[model samples]
Target: MAEPRNCSECNDSLYGQQFILKEELPHCIKCYETLYCDNCIACKQLIGCASKDVLFKNQHWHGKCFLCTRCNQSLVDQPFATRDDLLLCSACYCDEFSAKCHACLRVITPGSKKMEHKGFSWHENCFTCKLCQETIGTRSFVQKEANNYCLICYEKTFALQCFHCMKPIISGGVNYRDQPWHKECFVCSKCKQQLAGRRFTSRDDLAYCFDCFCNLFSKKCAYCTTPINGLGGSKYISFNEVQWHKECFNCKKCCVSLVGRGFLTCNNDIFCPDCGKGI
Candidate 1:
């Protein structure tokens, strides 16, 4: 017959009885629990043969003690996360540590898509245009104040319209007469020449080049038959529904200046007082 076995710790008889092998040594159930059972990492209680044992990273815990430290929910056979040596279920881990979406102010769970802008974060679905209420995925976007906008929505809502073409002026525009204009659209009304970075004038709300303005609108001198430029505060003489340059306002017979003094007009000709007596 085989030799009768005995408990390793207490030397008790193990004949025809159940026993536990620890380090290849046979022990009774009571001795095995007292001498070789693992203590629970969570509850600090021994995990005996009668109780289910859970082991993680070489640490042991009773089945009842193997739960999320935060929510106290069972982590057995479930996804879990560890933070600062504390066990947590996936839900509790996400709630306690995941980043929050900037738009909806809700937690953004791990393994989900997210968007980051500036210094804030958002869930993929929550990152949407403020005006159109549509998702703005990987496409281009714009941010205004505290709102996000799709490129189309941003242009429609905020871009200025060109004064001439009436189209959206996305960039590099001119502000004239309290109206916005595209650089290419701000041209002389009469000649169609580009007036940006060049001298131009407005007449009756129409923009014109200097030459066009002088020929189309400036007063003509009576004697010289030339346009009398009045831009930049230049002085000119006006009388009898006609205008003249100060140098051109001289007597026709004696060639003496008739400016700021008594003068006579004979058949659209100007004469000084002394020359007019003889004329």
Candidate 2:
């Protein structure tokens, strides 16, 4: 068989040009000459082209092209501009109906406008709820602290108070700063000393500064007026302000000058284990 002719446009030898082969083939059917293939343009795959045209600028393209790549829309009777090899139709190129958010100054669609003043448009809720960093929507927005805020933030920011120390939260009160405190924290108020672990609170709901309560009520040993050192002492007494060693306070029950083990206290008086059981 005779060798087929080469494509007039690409000049590549015709081997599988007659069949579908590797790419879509475009040919001058009248002269039986190959013109171009699918790979000639990138946009052709996205929106199919009806007919090809060679322009005076040496660019080849389909005559009836639709869809601008930049804005991803059908380009029907619309003016277009090119930037960075992508075509932007006139609507997207001019930013038609685009407006800046009044609060954030972010460029958003004009349809989102809620209020307008002095050539600026604002989202309605954002205009009222200005306090604290929050995205304000229309329904729950209100004015607070001389600024706008959402309903949830206003409650947490103002109403709640610390139960233990009675200190008002300055920041992050709702989630982080919580109510209620250790008894020791209130007792140590006068001395301003924060107790390590042990705590107590008065039944009256009055906050006692740490110093006055600990000094007045803590039990201690009679002899030393110091707190009982160990947990399981048999002898104990209310010495200065807190519970203390009773044997250290001069073991009165034995009357034999008791030594070694401490005595325990109940109510206001000291009692040895036998005497305490008899009573």
Candidates' C-alpha lDDT: 0.88, 0.49
Per-residue lDDT of candidate 1, residues 1-279 (tens digit): 454489888999998888977787888999888877899988898899999999999999999889999889889999999999999999999889999999788999998999999989999989999988899999888788979988798888998889788988766799999999998999999989989898998988899999899988889988998888877777889898988888899999988888888999987798888888966
Where is model 1 more than 4 Å wrong at Cα?
A: 1-3, 160-279
lDDT (0-100) at residue 240 of candidate 2? 34
Query: In model 2, where do residues sit more than 4 Å from their true spots?
Result: 1-72, 75-107, 110-126, 129-189, 192-206, 209-212, 222-279
**Per-residue lDDT of model 2, residues 1-279, tens digit only:** 454456544555666655222243433332232323332243443222334542323443444444577666755456666656665676675464356566766556534546654565666555655456665654554454446556666656664445655654333332212354443333444455554343533324443343445455555565566545444546664443544464564444654333444555565455566555655
Evaluated at residue 271, the lDDT of candidate 2 is: 54
Candidate 2 residue-wise lDDT at 135? 57
> Where does the lowest 10-residue lDDT sum fall in candidate 1?
1-10
